[model samples]
Target: MPKWISLDFGAKYKLSRLKLWFRGDLEYKDGNYPTDWDVYGSNDPNPDGSWDSWTFLHHFDEPYKPSGLPHKQYTQEDIDYARSGIDYEFIAIPEAYRFYRIKFNETTGNGAFIIITEMTYWGKLEE
Candidate 1:
């Protein structure tokens, strides 16, 4: 459910092509409004081994909707909701980052979804 992610290029990364995907509901629990989401560099890990600098690239609130059964995974259904859906949003990382971390504010609540069905991070491999 709640986890951290890292991507190391071992060189440099294209800030503009940074992308991510999540298959299920990413809605935080009650009052768990993430103040901001961040991306950091492992090369610049902090004292706690967490990425440093990790700039705020971008964040989304209810990015996408689905077609067909409105499920978590991608489907072949070409419904209008699918086209207008934004389940995933691309963000530009900083140019100097060698490793990155996606951070979000944590919260707790009953009958809430604290899970990330699926996630992905990819782009033009930097070298």
Candidate 2:
């Protein structure tokens, strides 16, 4: 099964970028990070709204392989890099949104889960 996470920004904002950090723990190495995912944004708060109400922001289909090492055994630098987070700039998206969603389609390991340690969104509040 696929996994997803949603964030409510409370109000509409001109989203500029997003930062995502995956779990850096040494024990949970297999399939800990997302390999394929899609990002969506929505301003409609109605629960009955359809999926079409959300706008597609981006789709990442590449594997999340920060460390080139085999067996997914990462070095200290890799761990630090993961902890620092990966940035996704939304330069093409000019619209404002009140909510953001991340849908995970695949993971690095055989597991069916995606482990994200942190998520940060940068944007300017709509006036």
Candidate 3:
């Protein structure tokens, strides 16, 4: 089974960039990060309880695979990286969407769960 999270921007916007952080300042060996996933955008007026009328945005396949002792254990750099968050810029999307979603694949984590410490987005309003 796959898991996902949805976001309602309350209005339409031509999204440009997305910033994300996974499990900040915590044990990294918990296998609580997404390994494979995809992002989607939707403008359907009634998209609740459904996965319909969505436009594909991006796919993340192990975008950041933690390796080595420091990643498993503790390190100032690792903590800082988690705290700083990762940025992803979209590639020229002309469509503006009021809703966004991140759908996870079966390969997310070993424990079948994901932990996102924080997230943010940047975009301009659409007509």
Candidate 4:
């Protein structure tokens, strides 16, 4: 099954950045971290039916590696770093969106599951 998550801000806002944190786990780690993902934004509350209005906000050509250390051998600092989500800065676009979606295509070790500890988005409300 494909993995995805969506968020509705309830009202349109000028988004600036997004943050994602990975779960701290060494074993069964295939799906613990995402290797490829994309983010989309839309003004429509329901964008699943048609993605025509959804704008492609960002895409990762390469997987994100939170810690430089190996997955199984993570130091305390590495674990702490992983727990703290990494920030993804969005383009300086003035568009406002009420809906946001994140799609994950691949994970660490290519496991069948994807694990995320937390997710956060920062932006200003549309004036």
The candidate that wins on lDDT is 2
TM-score: which candidate is best? 2
Which residues of candidate 4, in runs, are more than 4 Å off?
A: 45-48, 61-80
Global lDDT of each candidate = 0.44, 0.71, 0.70, 0.69
To one decimal, what is the Cα RMSD in angstroms of model 1 from the true structure?
A: 7.0
Itemize residue pairs with steric clashes in candidate 1. Answer: 39-54, 40-54, 63-86, 64-86, 64-87
- Candidate structures ordered by TM-score, highest first: 2, 3, 4, 1
Q: How do the residues 1-127 of candidate 4 rate in per-residue lDDT, one tens digit apiece?
A: 2577778888888888877776656422567767677778888745355557678887763334455555445556655665566667877755888888787877766766787777787899984
Candidate 2 stretches greater than 4 Å from native: 45-50, 63-76
lDDT of 4 at 12: 85
How many residue pairs clash in all the candidates, one count each? 5, 1, 0, 0
Residue 37's lDDT in candidate 3:
77
> Please, what are the lDDT tens digits per residue for candidate 2 over residues 1-127?
3777677888888878778777667332666766678888887745864576778888875433466665556677667776667777765676878888778887768577767777888889985
Which runs of model 3 end up more than 4 angstroms from their true locations? 45-48, 65-79, 106-108
Q: Which residue pairs in candidate 3 collide?
A: none
Higher-ranked by TM-score: 2 or 3: 2
lDDT score of residue 125 within candidate 3: 91
**lDDT (Cα, tens digit) per residue for candidate 3, span 1-127:** 3888888899999889888777654434455555567888888835465776778887775544333342345466555665667677888876899988888884433566777777889999986
Candidate numbers, best lDDT first, in rank order: 2, 3, 4, 1
Which stretch of 10 consecutive residues in model 1 shows the poorest summed lDDT?
26-35
Clash list (residue pairs), candidate 4: none
